[model samples]
Target: MAQEYGYRWGHSGLTADFDLDGDTPRLVRLARPGDHDLKGAVEAALPLVDVVLLGDGTGWSGPRFTGTALGPRLRHRAHHATYGDGWHHLTVELQDPASRLAVFVEYSSPDGVPVLRSRVRLRNDGAAPVTVRSVSSLLLGALPSPDVLDVHRARNDWLAECRWYAEDVRESVPDLGREFHGHDGRAGLRLAGRGSWPTDGHLAMGAFTDRTDGRCWAWQIESASSWLWEAGEADHHTYLSLGGPTADDHQWRHVLGPGEEFASEFAALALGDGFDGALAALTSYRRLIRRPHPDHEHLPVVFNDYMNTLMGDPTTRKLLPLIDAAAKAGAEYFCVDAGWYDDEGGEEDGSGAGGWWDSVGGWLPSARRFPGGLRAVLDRVRERGMVPGLWLEPEVVGVRSPVAAELPDAAFLRHEGGTRVTEQGRHQLDLTHPAARAHLDATVDRLVGELGVGYLKLDYNITTSAPGHLAHSRAWLAWLSSVLDRHPGLVLENCASGGLRMDGASLAVTQLQSTSDQQDPLRYPPIAAAAPTAVPPEQGAVWAYPQPDFTDAEIAFTLGSALLGRVHLSGHLDRMTLSQLGLVQEAVAVYKSLRGDLRTSVPFWPLGLPGWTDEWVALGLRAPVAGATYLTVWRRGGGVAELLLPVPHLAGLGDVRVEVLHPSTAAPGAGRAEWRGEGVRVRLGEAPAVLLVRITAGG
Candidate 1:
C-alpha cells in the first residue's frame, strides 16, 4: 500500500467548501460517488462541549463523512504500495449497527487542524518492524460533554482506533455490505457493523486537545504484539482511564504468522480524576463536611483493649489504675471494650451470648465480667475529668444475640437459620434499608441514653462489598447523623476493623478512625508512612497501632505522627510496667507540646513514592500570617534519603530558620537552624526523618 485518499479543506486528506448552493454544502469537483457537506459538523453534533480554547474545531468544513456510496471527501491510507517486500490487504468496511447510528471520526493536530497524511503502513511479510501511526476518529451525532474544551488532543477525548500490524487482525471481514439506517448518538465505530461484535459502551465521537509531548501528547504504544494509542487528557474531567489493567472487551487480536492468533487484547488508558472546578470547589466541599456542629461534642481519645491485649481482664481493677494513668496523661475519654459485658460467655465470661441478637444485638456490655456493668465504668471515667467513652460494634449482629431476634427481614442480609454474613463480621445490617436504620436507631439509644456514654467508637469490621454501588457511604452517614441527633453531644470516632472505609464520605460523619488494628509499634510506622501518599498531611493519618508490642522509643515516634491527623490510642496502662507507663507519659507530653505546630502545617510526600520497606518520609509546612516553618518527616525506614521538600505553590516564608528536634544516633530528622530563604535544604541521615521547626524574624 503506497497512498490512499487524502481529502482536506485546503490541504490533502479532506476538502471543505462553503454551502454555496442553498447551504447544502457544494462540491466543486467530486472524485467519489456521494456529494457531501460535513463542515462544522462537530459544532452541530455536540453543541454543548467545545474544543480547548486554543483551537475548538472552529475552521470546520473538511471530510464529507458518508457510508455505502463513497463521498467526495473519502479518506484512507496505503503503505509501501510500490515496494515488493510487503503483504498488503485493502478492505472497505461499514462500521454501523442499525439505521439509527451515524459515524463522525477525524484526526486533529494541537492547532485543531486535522491530520492530513492518511497513511496506513504495511510492512515485512514475516514479523518485521513497521513504522505505524493511526490518525483517525468517529464523532457521535449529539452526545455532549459540556465542561470539556477542544484544546484536548487525541488521548483524553472519546474514542480511538489502535494501530495494528498484519498479524494483528484476528480475521479480517474483507468486503462488508453496507445498510444505512437512522441516527444514534454512539457514531464512532459501529460494533456490529464490521466485526459483528458487541461493544463495551456506546462510543459517540472522539476528538483531540493538548499537543505537547509526553505529559500532554498522544502516542501509539506497543509492548510485544498489542497496539494501543494513548489519547484523551484527563485534566478538569473525570473519565475512567484504562491505566493499570486490561479492559473487559476481548474484541482485539493479533494475527500472528500461520496458526498464531491474538486474544486477551484490549486498549487501556488513564483518565482524569474528573472535575468539579478549582481548588475553591474542593475547599467548599470540605467545609460542608467539617461544619461546626454543637451536636458533635468533642470526644476525647479512646483507650482501646484489642491492641493492648487487655480483653477479658479477669482482674478488672487493673484497668482502673491504667485509667487513672491515662487520665493523668491528659486523655479526655476512657472506654472499656468487649470483656465488660453481662453475659459470662459473651466475652470469656461463659455466660453465653444470650443478650446479643439480630434485633438489639451488641447492645450490652459483657455482664459476667463487668458484673458492675458499663454504667459503673462510665461513672469512674467521669470522676477523672474525662467524658466516658464506650466501644460498640454497631454494624454487626451475632446470631445468638437478642437484638438479632427482633430485627425484621430487611434489617440484615439473612439466610435460613438467622445467620447473617457480611464483610466485617457476622450479620451485616444493610444500613441502606429502613429496617436496618431502625435497628441501629434503637441500639444507639440504649448506648447513648441507658448507658449514659458521651462518646461512641463505632466498629465496622467489614469493608463494603457492594460493587458499582453509590448508596452505602451516604447510608452510613445517615446512621451516624441519627446517632449524633440522638446523643446530641457525642463524638463518633469511626473504625472499620482498621482503616478500610476511610474515604471522602467517611470523613463527613466521624473525625478519625483507628488507622490499623495491629498498632504494633513496629507496624504503626509503616502504615503511617503510607498515609501521606493516600491523603494530604492536613488530614489524619492518626493510626493507633502502638501495642504493648512496641519499645518506648517506637511509641514516642508514633505519637509524633499526630501532626498529620488525630492519633488514636488503644491499650491499657494498667498492664504496662512502670517504665512503659513513663514512656507513654513522655510521648503524650511531646504530642501536647507540638499540637499547635502540627495543626497548622501542610504535609507533602516528597522523596518519591512510599515504598514497601515500611518507610516513607513526610514533610509538612506551616506558613500562616507570621509563623515558624514547621515540618515533620515520619521515616519508617532508615536510609540516607535526598530530602527534597516539595514547595509547589506554597508562598511566604521567604527567609526562615530550621532545626531538627530529635535523635542523636543519626542525622536529625530535624536539627540545627538554617535561614535558606523559602526553600530550606537539609540532610536527614538514617534517622526516620528530620523535624524542621522554622522561625522567622524581621520588622
Candidate 2:
C-alpha cells in the first residue's frame, strides 16, 4: 500500500514495512497475539524501549514489538492521533523544546463510532535528525468475519453511549470552575483497511491529511494489538513515549536531532471481548515491558475520599474542622466523598442513584442539609487554607435524572442475562458514544466551571463484576485521558471499589488510588505489605490512616503506606488520642524528608531482592544529589539479632560511618567494614536500622 509523500505500507504478521521518505524499516513481531497485550495497548500505550520481554507469551495482550530502524542512539519513539475521522487523526504541538518536540493528537466522535483512541507525539532533538525510517505493523490473531471486522457502538443498561475521541482541547474557563470549558478539534482520518500483519492476523492503515499543515505521509498496517513485533531481533521491540490516553499502559517520548526526522510507524491490532477480557490481556502485556515514562514517577500522591462530602453550607461547615486537622498533618488534598447535592435525593430528584451514575447538577446543595449551596462551603475551606475537592462518577447515570429525560439518543450498558432487575436504579455512561460525551462534557463543565472544585476523583468501582458491558480497557482509559485533557491542573484519583483497579494502566492516570476501603488499621498490615511487594511503590500513592486503631505501632506502620504512595487519613478524625496525634506528626516529618529522593530514583539493591525475609530490607538511592538510602529491617521472629548491612555501591569501605538506632532497647550495635576495590562491605547488628552515614571526602 502506498500513499503520497513516501509513505508505503506492508504487513505479513511477523514482519511489516513502511517506506517513509524512501527508507524502509522492517517492523518484526515480538510474541504471539493475545487478548491481554492488545488491551494494554488500548489502555496505556506508554512509550518505552524493548530492553525486557515477557518470557511466556501468556501475559502480554498482543504480539508486542519495537522498531529499531533508528536505534536507541537515534531515538525514534513517538505517538500519533487521528481526529473524529475515526482511525485516522492528526498531531498537534504541545511542547517543542530544542531538539525535543511534543505533538498533540485530537479527535471527537460527532460521527457514529463507539470508542475513539488516538496517539499524540514525536520529538526530534539531536545534533541533527537523519532521514526518518520506520515500519508499522500489529501483532495479530485471525478474527475472520466482516461483521466482527467492523466494530460498532453498543451500550449496557447502566449508561448511554457517546462519540468522543482524544484531542488537543482548546477549551478554557475565565475562572475554570466558574467560566467555561470546551475542546478544540484538530484533524480526523477515515478508516480503510491497509493490510494484514505477518506473524499474527491483523489490519493496518496510513496517515494522510489535507489540513493547513499540508503534511501528507503514508504509513501501513494495523494488526491485532497483540502481535506488535516479530522476527527482526532489533527492529520490533515494544517501546515508545506515551503522551495521552489513560490507565495502566506504556507511553513513551523520544528526542531526535540534526539529520534525524520524527517518524512513527505503527501496526494496529484489533481484538474484541469487551473491556474485562481486554484488561486481563492488558495485565499480561504490561507485565512484559517495565520501562518508566515521564508520568510514572511522582511524590507519592494519594486520594482522600472527602470531595463528595458537603456541597452546601451545613455539611461544609461540619467538614471544615476535619479538613483543617487533616491537611495540616502532611496531607495534600481531601476529596469530599459521596453525598453532596441531592446526591441521594430520589429517582424523581436525581438522588436514588447516588453511587456511580448519579448527577448532582447545579452542585445542588441539599436544601435539607446545607441550604447555602456548595460554593459557600468551598469558600470556608479555602479560608482555612486547604485544597478543596470532590468526586464524580461520569460513566454511570440514573434513570430518573432531570437531565436524563431531556437528552438525545443516549447509550447504555444493560444488566447481562440471568439477571432479574433490569432497573438497577442506575446506568453506566457510555463514554464511547457521541451523545453520551456531549452530556458528560457539559455536566463536568458545569460542576467544574460553575463550582469552585479544584480536584476531581473519578471512580469506576466495577470492572470484573459486570460482564457483557462496554468494559474494554481502551474505552474507559480513553475516557479518563479525555477528562484529564479537559482539566490538566486537577488531580484525579483512581477508586475502583477501594483499590480494586490498581494495575499498570489505571495507575497511569490515577496518580493516586485508594488502596482498600477497609480503613481498619488492623487490616492495613497484610494488604499494605503485599502492595510494595507486588507492584512498584509509585503507583500505590496515598494509604489513609484507617481510624480507631491509631496506635504507635500503627503510626510507624501507617508510614508503611509511604512506601506504596501517599499516606491517607481515614479514621474518625474527632477521636484521636493526643499521643497518637504526636506520633503521626513525627512520622509525617520523617516521610517528608525522604520523599523527594524516593520519587525520582531507581531502587538499587545489594541483595537485589525485595520484601523477602531479612534482618531488614536495604535500598540504595542512586541520585547524585540525594545519593543515600535508608534500609528498614523490622525485628523478626528470632528477634533481629543482627543486621547485615551492605554498601555495594559505595567506592571504599574505610570512609563511611554507620549510625546505629536501636528499637525497644539501646544495647548498642557495631559497624564493621571490609575493603573491596570496586565497592564496600559494611555490617551492623542489633540496631533496628543502621543509617549509612557517609563522611565527606575532605573531612
Off by over 4 Å in 1: 1-284, 294-302, 311-315, 342-360, 414-425, 432-434, 463-473, 529-541, 544-552, 575-583, 593-601, 614-616, 621-629, 637-654, 659-699
Query: Candidate 1: minimum summed lDDT over ten consecutive residues — where?
Result: 192-201
Best by TM-score: 1
Report how far off residue 491 is in candidate 1 (Å). Answer: 0.8
The Cα error of candidate 1 at residue 93, in Å, is: 38
Per-residue lDDT of model 2, residues 32-118, tens digit only: 223122222211122222222112121123322332212122232332433332223433233333334332333211122121222
The number of clashing residue pairs in each candidate reads 102, 147
Candidate 1 global CA lDDT score? 0.38
Stretch of 10 with least lDDT, candidate 2: 155-164
The TM-score values for the models, in the order shown, are 0.55, 0.50
Task: Report how far residue 641 has shifted in candidate 1, in Å.
Answer: 8.2
